[model samples]
Target: MENYNKLKSLVASIEADADKFFNNGNSAAGTRVRKGLQDIKTLAQEIRNEVTSKKNDEKK
Candidate 1:
């Protein structure tokens, strides 16, 4: 549950940064957006692994 909330927050930040870069044409926002996206991808992979691990354990 906590991780889920963190993921939501990261998603929100990514959207905000994208808006700043695309809508406002702020160059600095682009860097932030890229970083946020990377963070999200890493986190998503971690969560996926955790879920898969649990499923595998259950089957064992």
Candidate 2:
């Protein structure tokens, strides 16, 4: 649940930066958005692996 909240927060931040970059051509904001997106990808994979492990544990 904590991780879920963190993921949501990162997505919100990325959305803000993306809007700034798209609407005003801000390179710095674009960089931040890209970084946030990469974080999301990493955290998402961690969560996925955790869930998969839990499922496997239940099966075993």
Candidate 3:
């Protein structure tokens, strides 16, 4: 749950950079957005693994 909240916050934090990169023409913001996306991907994978682990545990 904590990590889920962190994921949401992380996305929220990246929103401004995403907007600047997409709606405007900010190269630096684009770089930040890309880095944020990579972080999001890694976090999402962690969340996936956690969910899978919890589910398997419940099966016992």
Best by TM-score: 3
Q: After superposition, how far is residue 2 of candidate 3 from its true place, in Å?
A: 0.7
Tens digits of per-residue lDDT, candidate 3, 1-60, equal: 988999999999999999999999999999999999999999999999999999999999
Off by over 4 Å in 2: none
Itemize residue pairs with steric clashes in candidate 1: none
TM-score on alpha carbons, each prediction: 0.87, 0.89, 0.96
Q: Per-residue error at 3 for model 2, in Å? A: 1.7
Candidate 3 positional error at 59, Å: 0.3
Whole-model Cα lDDT of every candidate shown, in order = 0.89, 0.90, 0.96
lDDT of 1: 0.89
How does model 1 score by TM-score? 0.87
RMSD of each: 1.1, 1.0, 0.6
Backbone clashes (count) for model 3: 0
TM-score of 2: 0.89
Clash totals, every prediction: 0, 0, 0
Worst 10 residues of 3 by lDDT: 1-10
- What is the C-alpha local distance difference test score of candidate 3? 0.96
